[model samples]
Target: MSEQQKTVALEAELDALRREVQRLRARNAELEADRGFPGRLVDALPSLVYVLDLEERRYVYWNRELAELAGGNIGAAAGPLRGDGLSSMFHPDDIGRIEGYRARVAASESGEQATVEYRARGRDGGFRWFLERGVALGRDPEGSGRRMLGSAHDITAHKHTEQMLERSESLLHAFLEYTPSMMVAVDVEGRLLLVNREIESYYGMSREELLGKVVYDLLPPAASASIRKANDEIAAAGQPGASEHVLVYPDGPRNYLSTKFPIRDAEGKLYAVGTVSVDISRTKQAEAERAEMQRRLIEMQQATIQELITPLLPLARGVVAMPIVGTVDPARAEQILTTLLEGIAARKARIAILDITGVKGVDAHVAQSLVGAARAAGLLGTRVVLTGIKPQIAQTLTMAGADLSGIVTKGTLESGIAYALRARRRS
Candidate 1:
């Protein structure tokens, strides 16, 4: 009875063990399917997945995406990339960066991660930008990197956009810097967001010091206020306007013709003010100098004309003859008197003959001027002999109540000269 019972129990135990083995195999199959699902997902992804055995300094695995991009399995024994180094895939300009990032990730502790963006050359002879992220996966026995898991995303489109933006900004900066005028951009709050080289040089400051500073911080109070007002008007009107500004420099006061306009975004909203200040100091100073020179030139021309009109000529010893030609106004009359006295004193003339043969018309001022000249000459001990007195002029002078009775009058210049000679003989 004991042998039979033992045999039956053993058979039952064997059956239960078989069932357990079958259940365990089923569970293992399920777990393998789960793992295979993730592997399939990785292969199907657009991003390239890879594993690097840093201990051996070689890439251990790469997904299908990388194999397709590289034209072969990156890790397969018969693949085109089988023995090639990972650095060969990178662009020459990016090799150093890729190598540096790899080294940094390898030196990091487990679970450490790093990201880098670089250009990778494909088998198609095209370069594409990749934003690759690497994670350290534990270390080897020698305290060196064992494995690194990384994913590379093709960021070529994003990089292109970034480059385009950078180029646009660079072009704008160059245009502003090389412009002849001082260009400045300020936000609505009056903070300086951008300034050209001219502005920096004009203010004697650097971009770092000027940027983000208020407009009033760098300029004189009056200039700042004026600029602010102009900016406000431009912003309010959404149109360009101009104003004059004076900036005191180390050398002297400099004038500027500033044109200010509003800068709008794509939505046509005013966000900044653009100012272009053209230096007008030299132009203004030159104009002022030209005007002064013109004044001096006019004075010189008048003096030459006056000398031409009145000439006191020496006729005989101690006698001077002056002839008035053309029209004689009060100024010319005064000039005539001055020249007569100077000649009389220079020649020590006791007799002076005044000629008016070319006289056209004589006004009251001219009459008074003649009378005044005679009295002045008499005081200098010179007897003035008036000549070439037209009857009409004499009547006009007499009717005008001009007192010329003390002056000796002659009808002709020849008579005056004769009388002067006779007077000289008497002297």
Candidate 2:
């Protein structure tokens, strides 16, 4: 073993070591390049990417997207990434939610996935909705080495749309609940779908309890048949119709006028029936009142005609006695005068008694009718006798300037009749 031999062996060994180092360095360079690609790709992505240190509950690696989102570098952000509780980017309102999600994620096993929606501050200094999805990368039994990989998406527009839909639905519900009119919507089969507060209160049931019940089930048997007929008509016609009907409620009988129509879908196929009911008890009562008034008017007209025509028949004996009752308006005055003149001419009577004992008073029109009747009787070769003048009647007749100089007078119908009979005998 010589010095030359030792030196040669050492140089060979050193060469072998150097080759191994070169191979290892090449593998290291490949691995570094592979890692750099994903990092660079993540930084260039539009959405934020993060690697979270679960044990510390902070971001371990953050991309440029997150840096820009947070309005600062990832390490400097005020949230969990900066080790300052959680990101100040999170809305104060969403802090509890983020913490809860983090706890849930922590409790899950490695590779477990979770998602959460939270509010994050945007670069524009406004809060925007964000959806974060996280997968557990690893977990430490000691609770210090847990980690997660996550990505976040800006869901501001989607959240805003959801909020708008919620508001619109809320408004529709409120409108149905608060409107004063009794409104109801039913399926084509007459199953109740929706009813307003008024209907619920009127029917003495909650809306939830009443839904899906048949309309007929809530009504009395007598009313159910009629309401079913109306609903069927509306469905068949696909048009609105209104009618009044009597309903027997738990409270008692009531009159209701209902307007009903079909509700159509987008394709114009009838889907449901909608109805608005107005309580018409008052209106029905008013109609009854009008009918009574009309009946009274007809009765009065008939009675007046009878009274005027009956007395005229006896005028043929050369004398007639007529009794007037009730206050006389122009209409009655015309009837009386026309009857007396015609009677005098037909009967060829020499004397006729116009009795007013039953009369309360005479207006100017009545006085004129009486005067005209007397003059007409004179032309017919008849003498007119005015009788039964109360103090008020005399005053009214005098004030009206009626000429009664050619007429005889009596105080009552009996007296007028007696005078007429005596005059008839004398004739």
Candidate 3:
């Protein structure tokens, strides 16, 4: 046959098996001219072509490719294969489906074809996927097809690639849907390309509404400005940007920590941007609460120290004395006066003693505070006695013009307590 005629004949068989009925009709007229050409051409085709005996479950006629696929060269004897021969090469999981496919093909109409996908075990013991197009070569006497012509192409690589893509897509979908963080992908123009379920739920927008919307338009003005600045920073620096922003919702303002990064092509050119945002309002509230608690605790501690610095002791039933230690500020001096009067009222004390032995240099303000304490004690039916006074503090009180007329003086705290007890006995 001429090359052009050979090419035409080869395409007719390899590519036109789906129209096997029409091809078989024309094949009879060309059989004499084609002679051995069809056999050699079928053997040269990439796919495996076979005419099977459906009733016996064996190949009646197959190409050289089927022989190699069926392990003829590896171990099987060099001849036409026998009973259960071709069916045994199919995977165990698919062995049942093969019988169904053959039954369907046998029952098919003259021009109809049955397409099925199945895995078949190769000679090397690995299973490979096959996409087969089979049809009835001829029908039996009972109006059922008994012979089938099939063209099978190996599709294992395509199947594996599709499976991997599907798995990756499923994993990405699950992460976006279930993760707590809000994630979004936007094109360079700031249009939203992808948004997770969390993002949609957080913003109270449906996926249909959120998609294709500009991210900047959806966010509050301040938040969008911050996001825009962060995007610009990363775009210039070629790194990810992280920032904290406040978004005002219908309820209130919420704090969010967001990280923005560029999605780049393999050549390192930016194409889009991705953002992951997490709400930090609870964390900020916790920090504020901790700080407030610390402030309150410090105030409580200072109040406790004020009491510890000036401890009022009841020397007798009708008298009390407080030994003031350390330097006394006006605030502490006022605290001292308040404690003295309260102690006198609570104990009904007639005599109160102030110990200034531990007092540092008293300023004019502190001296006046002490003088006021003496006058206030006297009004409460208590005589305020100054005890353990240093000479410099006495000089300071005199120089400050503090009145000492009603206030009694003593050399020591023990002496003051003795005088108070004796005075109480006399009264």
Candidate 4:
């Protein structure tokens, strides 16, 4: 209970504490020795493992891979890796991103991990993409970053693959958007899945407005019906089919040659119908115009032929000679009748000489046509004089029951003209 006894007890307790501390240190060393070789183990890994003193902005510990990635020995003698040190190691465009990640990791709580991907300069002086993940170890007394541990894995191949995929998607999008035909895809339920720029432009609507809508919703009932029929046929046959229809736009109607085909996946299961329509309105209009022109041309040709066959020549003051050449069918006979009646009314002719010098033979119909013409002209007060009937034609007409008794017959066109003039003089 005295001061000496208390002092002795305090010394004993202090000595015991020191011995316990020494034993703990020895145990830690033994544990470290029992583990695998740290240097060889770290150097064998492909990824760059490192520890950093964030307060001093220096790499406290780094593996051989880290040194190789940095293109230098990475230790205390290598100098601190701050903004400038890191900027030199990263791509110029990626420096800002690296700095942003550094700031984030420095502010993170202990055991909080942060990941960043950036292009880093390699030993070969070429930049390669790397994915780095860091955990905040602890903070300093002032609440600043004290230490951090991280690993960096080369992701150059992954980044390159990503870029290639992006380019392929962009190219496919461009091809679908700018193709000239109106391309569209509809699901089995008739819902639109895809639409091209041509379809958007032709319908004056955006793809957003067209997609997910039923084809019937975008088109008139008539047009939608036709399209539905074509789609059904394609779906049933699992093949392509052609359809032509008029697409009535807000401006006007346009003809389109639509080709519909079944869309199948690699598994050969029919999933949708793909349609490609080309505007054929101009072609259709051209064909219609050509047909109209052909009809008009035929009318002109017939008019020319009729005029050549029937020619009325006036000889005397009151006499007119109509010379008919070539065989006259019923149509030509009707034309002759019309010409003779018109000429008689215009000229007020007292005698009309009908010349048929070019006639080979007159059948029953031809003889009737002549009789009908003469009777019609008599009713109009124009006497008929038939000319240019050969003897064999006259005999043929008589044998075929010809009834031209009431018509005056002449041998030649000249004789007919002379007779008409003589009759006019007497009058």
Candidate 5:
């Protein structure tokens, strides 16, 4: 235990330590040589590969893909983010999301991977999307995963595609929900695929309740059968057709003009049917009203003509004039007789003038009707005078053997009226 003995022993131990250090360095060199091809392969990958220390919140290794993604060089994001470095290389909005993604990776068990989509800012000052898939690389003393190995693939194109699809679906839904006419589309199975607002309102149901429902089940048997026939015809002919059918409800029945057509896919195969209907019940009602009004108008016109043809006018007190115009058929001759008698009784006229000044021809029936009116007035103590005795009319009455014995005859209506006035004054 002397000083000299202790120095000798210390020197021997130092020598042994030096030999052990050299052996360790040689072993390290051998391990590095063995990793040559694998390291190169990892560097050659297209994916941005990295190893992260979950507990340290920093990166342990990064491949060359990081440099390529950051635009030919790492630049600000060359390695793990330094103080405030993350804000410069990654989108500010996505920075907050990284913590949540990291937490999920840290909590996952071995062999289980977690995926996150985030945006990163490149050298061009534009943001690009990346999908990171991370798995637990190691665990801590408490068995919690603290290290993560992950790869990120650029997913900007895929994200754009998904966004476009969502936009298209939204536009289609809007068109189907707001149109004015009743419209519906059904698959071959008769399941409702689309319905517009008008259809929903007409059926007294909401879109949520109507879609996927069977059209046949919602309608009456008569309506459903008619619609089925139309649909079948359209499908078989592969053409569009129009039809009219009545759909009834508690309120009433509605007449609809519907256009039903087959819907074909790109392969020209029939897969669905669409119907657009317009309610025409009001049109039908208006037509019926118009027809009824026309009938009434015609009847009124005929009554007015009858009144004009057979008129009995009072010339003065105790004197009435019957001016007959146009051809007198048997029906009209009777009307004249009835009117003359009624006029004499109603006005208490003592004289009646039968003026045929405008008559074209007097047949036996007409001559007889005139004599009958004169005799009928005589019974009421009213004298009758006949005027407008044209030469042809006198000859015809004589040839028919008609009797005008008691009836006074005048050549013109003016002479008849003047004579009656004079007779009245004398009486």
Candidate 6:
């Protein structure tokens, strides 16, 4: 080849090489820009970002976010870290979990990722929940060896939310336990789901043991049927209903007033039934006593009217006599006067005898009542004979200064009857 031709070929080669060098420089600039962009963004990010070398078992590369989290700059944070050294920040309680996760990551050689939630100690000496995720980078070209790159994300907020929900549930259960009335919750099928402490007496069993059992199982057949019917109605209506029932417990039957209502969810769907029972045994007993007293009062009134009116039904021309017994108090005196006056008018008797043969004693007020009744009878045209005055009664009458001037007195009921008959004949 000629020298000049070789020079031309060299120049051509030089031009092509220069073009290639310029292209290479442009590409390098783009790559540098991209690298610095990601690095800066990652360093300034609020969340920690990291790459783990599973084989070395340490954080390979970390951003400034992680460095700040470790209480240092990136250089200082990475200086002491070899592979797998990030485990040092794991809480003691989570060390076993971290070791297990590391083992899982190392064993995974298929380029797949492993994720776990674990606790890590912050620089502030507090533990934070983290979700650790790792994937094998390139331990094997066929993805059959363990070489992992991993990152952890803080999930403390989510953990806190879960813990708060658990606490709220515990508080609710505690409140139910301490409530006074017997409270119970049952599923749609009428199986008991929850029962409060007060239900222990009603069911005759521990609340724990009663769960999942049908309410009918603890009640008498008749009472269970009635309660079940009411519950069904309330559930169907999605409202409240109340009933009084007798619960047969181990101790025996006890009365209770039970109120039942349906429990609904936010969307207005029927979920379960809630019930509260109040002990009404005392109130029931009081009501019964009131009823008995009323009945006795009615009976007494009827007996009084019957005794006063029965003897007057058949009127005769002969005399009618009323014999009173027992100590004569003011109330008894009033009753005797009322009976004698009413009987004289009813029977149209010309003469009537008021005998206190069995009377052992009398007060001054009673003697005065007797004299007044005799005067009232005389005005009604029926001659009154006051009979059966014993010695004591006579003494009391004298002491009372009661005027018996026109009242006829006899010592015995027999004499009074005889005197009444003679007076009736004379009239």
Give per-model TM-scores.
Answer: 0.62, 0.57, 0.64, 0.68, 0.57, 0.52
Compose the digit string of candidate 4's lDDT tens values, residues 115-202: 9998887878888999999887888788767788888999999999999999998986897787887889999989989888988887
- Give one digit per residue, the lDDT tens place, for model 1 in 1-427: 6999999999999999999999999999999999899878999999989887766666667788887776533534453232245556678898778778878888887787899999887657788899999988878777767778889999989999999999999999888879888889999999999998988888778999999999877778888887788888899999998999888888888899998989999998999999888999999999999999999999999878766778778888888888887888877787888888887888888888888878898898887787788889889988888898888888878888887766888999888888888877887
Find the 10 residues in a row with the least total lDDT in model 3. Answer: 72-81
Task: Report lDDT (Cα) of residue 150, candidate 4.
Answer: 83
Please estimate how well model 2 matches the true structure, expressed as its whole-model Cα lDDT: 0.81
Among these predictions, the greatest TM-score belongs to: 4
Which residue segments of model 1 deviate by more than 4 Å? 1-68, 72-87, 92-113, 122-128, 135-150, 153-186, 192-227, 230-269, 273-294, 329-349, 363-372, 375-381, 390-406
Candidate 2, residues 189-217, lDDT tens digits: the string is: 88999898988887889999999999888
Scored by lDDT, model 5 comes in at 0.84
Supply every candidate's count of residue pairs whose N, Cα or C atoms clash at under 3 angstroms. 0, 4, 1, 0, 0, 5
Model 5 lDDT per residue over 259-296, tens place: 99999999999989999888888997898899999999
Which 10 successive residues of model 5 have the least lDDT summed? 78-87
Candidate 6 has a TM-score of 0.52
| Candidate 3 deviant stretches above 4 angstroms | 1-67, 73-85, 92-117, 130-158, 230-262, 265-268, 279-290, 314-318, 329-350, 359-382, 391-406, 423-427
- Cα deviation in Å at residue 388, candidate 4? 2.2
Q: Any runs in candidate 5 off by more than 4 Å, and if so which?
A: 1-91, 119-131, 137-183, 195-214, 236-243, 257-261, 266-268, 276-427
